[model samples]
Target: MTTRTPAAAVAALTLGLLLSSCALLDGSTGGDPTDAPSAQASERQRPTPPFVRQGRMSIEGGNDVTFELTVTGLEHDGEYLMLEVTHNYLEDLPGSVTGRNPPVRLVDPVSGEVLRFLHDPQSGDEPYGTHFVPGDPAMPTHEGLPTTLRRYFPAPTQDVDYLTLTGAGIGLVPGIPLTRVDAFTPAPEPNAHEYIDPETFAQEPELPDEIWYPDNPPPPGLDTADRRQTMESFVDGPTASTTRAGDQETIALHADEMFAFDDSEPTADAAQTIRAGAQTLRSHIGPRVEEITIVGHTDGVGSDTHNQTLSQERAEAARALLERELDGEFTLTIEGRGSAEPLATEGGPDDEQARARNRRVEFTYQVSPGADGSADTDGLASARRHVAEPAHFFDELEPVTTLIHDDVDLHVYPMVRDGAYAFQMVGLQNSTLSPLEADLDVDASAVPGGPAQYTQGTLGGFRVQEPDTGLIRYVVRIRTGDGEYEDFADRINELATGEQYLALAVFPAPAPDVTEMTLYAGAFGQVDVPVR
Candidate 1:
């Protein structure tokens, strides 16, 4: 992942001037030094900047959502004017639009000039400017909190005295004076970075007869909808609707069919059953199956922990058996969900019949749409260590950001791999009466030219974060953000309140050098989270 180009790795900060010549991550050109002070002057006045703000204001989204956007002060960061904002969301239940980068415009108080946010119009709105926010769409409102955000606008000239804000839905905020220049937080210099080149395939590389993409090529909607429809089909019988070959196909198997009562090991006759399942996979997947995911489940018969492990073990056993039939030449993933997810939700815990029904494994196979005898069969490297939850991640969990309003604490424990720097994001003690949700992907902006993550758009979004020197690189391999691990998305989406679950979210990996990266956590300002 560190194979950055000479142009990508050039550190703009080392050049001394804030507006030094360098390629911005958003695929935009940079370096109009005329707006910035000389390097010597910028370094001299880097600290103890003056404060310049009058107060805050409120704006209603017409119905329901309201924002408490305050102009805390102003800072001159080279050519950009950093407007410090204290955004307090008022009068809403949990899951409001707190963690989002809504569009903002600036109206020059005197000249009546409207300054739209200066950014790559093609890029997703998040972590505005050079900051990366997982390149996801703006997250829906979460329980509103008191937090400060910095919006960088092209600095108003010395002639312009004040500027008012025009926000989407939130409407216009009061005016803020623009006096001092070049005394705000300077944008971090981008390090020599490494990433994929879109133009490399620019002539619109033929879309494979089918996209050999993730479960959700662009997002979860289609895949989830398919799953929902598949479940519906299951009610009618185990019939697959889309079996054009090389597309996605799913098969369901009851636990009783593969294992004896209370056992993880496959039964003797299970070999034939698994072989049949594998044949079904091979026939429907056609020439090459790019990926196979086996999800195991159990009824609410045992403790959650025990049930989860049992389910996992069963899934693993099933995988091993399938591999024997396939000669270990296919992509496979095994997951277990003890009683945490029962197929028979309405069934009581002690119901043996329902538990038996809940005990099962699901096999989902995806084949590269245009696969031939000579196609690339490499699938995403399956997690060597499967975790039932984020707590099992190989990193220490620590609170990274604490927001206002809701009793939610954002914690991140960094996980740096050889190719990327990923973090395990967690939201704790969401005391709302409903489940609280937080999408780090939706909340954070992806860095320009950042490594591709699972959450990236079809056009792709960069999620790399280079701090200080350009030596370390943080690349994101999109996390599911389904709250299976990070719980924030789960709780919030589920609207589960008054719960204290240590929900963890594991972001993709980053380069090893980035032991720590600075993130502007809500309300806390800039906080450095160490990638442990």
Candidate 2:
């Protein structure tokens, strides 16, 4: 599932800072599964409601301040009201709202002066209407936080230019009463959702499962600086509404218009329906959209990957249409699954209606104020200087032999020669004064060999003799072509920190010519030395 967010800009900035401090990659933290609200700012003070003159209305127990307009006696089929609204009433945000191009006029009814609030808060050039959709109760012209109310109105009417409200001031519909639902505070902003202590920005968070694998390296293509943006990503729920129409379950997509698939290319009627659907989405939702992820699903009739691709393509096609027709207000990301994620779990093949429902595009919204702009990051920005990067054995030289040496209780394997080597070994404690010893066997093959041919042999057991004066010498003997003795070396090193394996690699003198070698105990064999 795709995730979208509202304060993604801030979240991204904060996340980037945390990731830069630690090192991680950019990707989603999984959507909706973690929908905790932000805890960045201090508690918002109880808001003061806007005043209206027509009738008496109060925002009951709800914390959100509501502006109620009683339409009991107004001599008309509908009504409208105008007022200056700002989202962040507690703070004065300059340029937070703009009317620059296509210059807008916010005519204040009382003062006759243009009052500009943050962003454009109009559904259309109106008397914002109060017409109710069928089955819906005769409700207010608007309901919800100022942002939600402005997002969708029943219908814009001629009686009002526009009904404006701040995030704190919500315009009420005619009959439905306003209520401040709860008093819960949002959680603090996380430094990194799955990577660091969400509260204490400096600490690391519980890591995800993928990081534990030795073979899994951090993805290289992503900009580490941008990883924080992933924290702000989230899913905002399904976009299409499902309901029963006639004998079938129908899903009405919220967009400019609605369209039914009949045959080749969308009909004008279908196009119009899509247009209306899109319009509905716009009127009820602003386009501060970061990414519009569309996932198209299908009935299970093909391979999982194929179905998945189909579903994704369906979503992509819908997104393409939306972007092309809607002035490119959204960045569309599309995906298709032929038949994998199904909405109806118990329906039979006879249920074409249910199958059709399953084969649909699911829309999710991701929001961010600075999605396209440079958001001020939360912490000090710094650069990381890597001491080294991994090099490959094939790139430097080819391995003539691949060896697998597993002795009782110990196992080691070499995949590439003359590169990095790794193995596991455990020492045996002997009762005799002499220490036990073992040799590493090798298997070689290839072409060229005379002595010059690739030869494999064993080394080590360089003689782990009796201890002397509390000091011990562990020797490593090398072997070359045709079981010939090579060179021998010894290390009177410290008793390893503990029983473990070690891995390292060294370039031999050449084919059949044994050069230097190393033997390590414990799991430490993965050591790679820089070849200068």
Best by TM-score: 1
Worst 10 residues of 2 by lDDT: 227-236
Angstrom error at residue 198, model 1: 51
lDDT of 2 by residue, 391-463 (tens): 1111112222222333312222221111111111122111233323323422111111111111222222211
Q: How close to the true structure is residue 434 of candidate 1, measured as C-alpha lDDT?
A: 49
lDDT of 1: 0.38
TM-score for candidate 1, please give it: 0.26
- Which runs of model 1 end up more than 4 angstroms from their true locations? 1-232, 235-247, 286-288, 346-350, 367-532
- Report the error of model 2 at residue 334, Å: 1.1
Query: How big is the RMSD of model 1?
Result: 24.9
